[model samples]
Target: MTNQGFPRGLRILTAGEYRHVFEHASFRIHGKGLLALATPNDLGHVRVGLVFSKKNVRRAVDRNRLKRLTRESVRLRQQWLPSVDIVVLSRKGVHEIDSETLARQLHGMWRRLEKDVKRQPEHQQ
Candidate 1:
């Protein structure tokens, strides 16, 4: 898993890591059917976590599809992203959208998250 892919190192692997982002996120970038909460991290690269509930996506297949779409989007955009931890939450209607649209939405959220986080004061960074 190089920097070019979604390596283990780039994932928010533990409950505590996810908790920190949820508790202290400085930027909340919302997209259609998605919400991304992000905060600066001490690590020198971006990390991501997904929260696609079965209650929202309804089926295991749909949930897996959403996760795949999100991970693929994150993997493709990770290089230029600022060092931060992000938790992405999915809404009920996510399964209705096509993969391309969902990917575009996720990409836009990442771009916005990158811009907003970089613009924050040094303390937040």
Candidate 2:
């Protein structure tokens, strides 16, 4: 099978999109310096957004690295994820962790979110 790229439709773009997921999150997980917020979407596919503030990562290089790792983690697990909009927020001390550790945290977070999404009522989720 051919692999399609991570297009705009598969991403939570724009401030409004981010705000919606943040304000109306149906599930959340806090692991290490990662805070994952998820809300069901009508698009019938999983979309992810990354939030790496200067206060958290300090350096632009670090922020970009975290973002890349987070994206890779999400992409690898998207097939099993529920149709939801997810936003991963980086907190203080996130810059200290390496990509492998960060990826592990993200994996755990996604598993937690999958459980939460499945537990929700048919109408709500």
Candidate 3:
């Protein structure tokens, strides 16, 4: 079994990584101001990346809050995720939602993606 612990390895760190997910995403979900895009990886553990644009939130404090919320949620649930690279993008109005609501929406998106990825054919990967 793969290491379920989320260390540095379980993260999309490079520009190319972000590009790969964007170019070859097999699963995608949009929720409120958040958009999650994912593609299967050969690695045995899931990895995630986040993108919060200033144009969307228009405030550094709100953008940081979104990132913090996202990382916390992903960190808690990452062990159950499939081997995939995921990128999260924020749109306008993300900061308006409360953290609990934001979390609920994010979790729902993850659940949908989990099901979608499982149903995809190997060729899609």
Candidate 4:
């Protein structure tokens, strides 16, 4: 899947999508941030979106930095992740972390998400 820049496309925007992420998806937290994901039924490719609010990170620069870091992290790990629409929300600590640290944390989070998905029972036809 290609990297659909964070806010440009039809992503998890509504309350319903957010609720689905919170209720149905499995999550994993890391030092840099938290990743919440749900695998879509379609057997296509993966797509990702980032949620770095100005409220959480006051400065525009900081928000953009965090989004860039998250996008890069997701791009690098895209191959391993399942075909799903993943939404990544940044925590306060993400602003305090460096890019390298963020990358590491993201890698760990990705692995955990994958494990969580694997543990779920496969669908029966």
Candidate 5:
């Protein structure tokens, strides 16, 4: 059986890594309660970072729930994503939404990001 866990390589762990995407975002995918900013990477695979501030999520448990859901969504769909670094930002009131709705929103954003990348092949190096 293949490993089905979130690996460290698929994560943007350092502050500089997150800043790289924030400073040079190639695509911005917007959802109801979330925003994903992406910048190209040469790693030939997708990497993701999630931002769920206390001001936005308000509760530790809610932040963890959102982070878990986001990570699962990314891990499952990583194969379909472009070679880029993505930072997912949570908006205020995001914790109020149900898991299904949040998942759906994330799915749409991923699809949108794929389409946007395809549309701008020149963006990729």
Candidate 6:
């Protein structure tokens, strides 16, 4: 459970992984394109996943940009986050919003999510 670099081996991408996060994880919506879900992982660092579906955003460039912004937002705030599996999903509105606004919304969302996570009972291994 070492804290590997972001996007190296720390993202939840598989179907099974998303299923587990949705079923067992706790989440909060931060903004139109920003949602955060947290699940207990044996790994001792926060792992992030970005979901920018083609259905939500048609262009590959837009999708990649959104994912990049999401990743950067999380990375910049990594120090404040707990060690958990975190997933960030992008909605249609994400493409229309500017990066500064998105980042601010993400920060606010993370803060609220952090509070909620702290209130949950510790996960059983």
What is the C-alpha lDDT profile of model 5 across 1-125, one tens digit per residue?
Answer: 44566899999999999999999998999888888999989999999999999988889999999999999999989888899999999998899999999999889999999999989868354
Regions of candidate 2 where Cα sits further than 4 Å from its true position: 2-4
lDDT tens digits, residue span 1-125, model 1 = 55576779999999999999999988999888889998888888989999999888898988899999898888887887889898999987988999989988888888888788768888745
Compose the digit string of candidate 6's lDDT tens values, residues 94-116: 78888788778888887877887
Would you list the rank order by lDDT, best first? 5, 2, 1, 3, 6, 4
Write the number of the candidate with greater TM-score, choosing between 4 and 5.
5
Off by over 4 Å in 1: none
lDDT of 1: 0.88
**Model 5 CA deviation exceeding 4 Å by range:** 1-3, 123-125
Please state the error at residue 111 of candidate 4 in Å.
Answer: 1.0
Task: Give the distance in Å from residue 40's predicted Cα in candidate 1 to where it truly belongs.
Answer: 0.5
Worst 10 residues of 1 by lDDT: 1-10
- Candidate 4 Cα RMSD after full superposition onto the native fold (Å): 3.8
Give each model a TM-score.
Answer: 0.94, 0.94, 0.92, 0.73, 0.94, 0.82
Off by over 4 Å in 4: 1-23, 28-31, 39-43
Q: Provide the lDDT at 90 for model 3.
A: 94
Alpha carbon deviation, residue 41, candidate 6 (Å)? 2.0
For 1-125, candidate 2 gives per-residue lDDT tens digits of: 54546777879889999999999998888999889888999888899999999987889999999999988887878788899999999989999998889888889998999899888998865
**Clash count, candidate 6:** 0
Per-model CA lDDT versus the true structure: 0.88, 0.88, 0.87, 0.65, 0.91, 0.75
Candidate 5 — worst ten consecutive residues by lDDT sum?
116-125
lDDT, residue 64, model 5 = 99
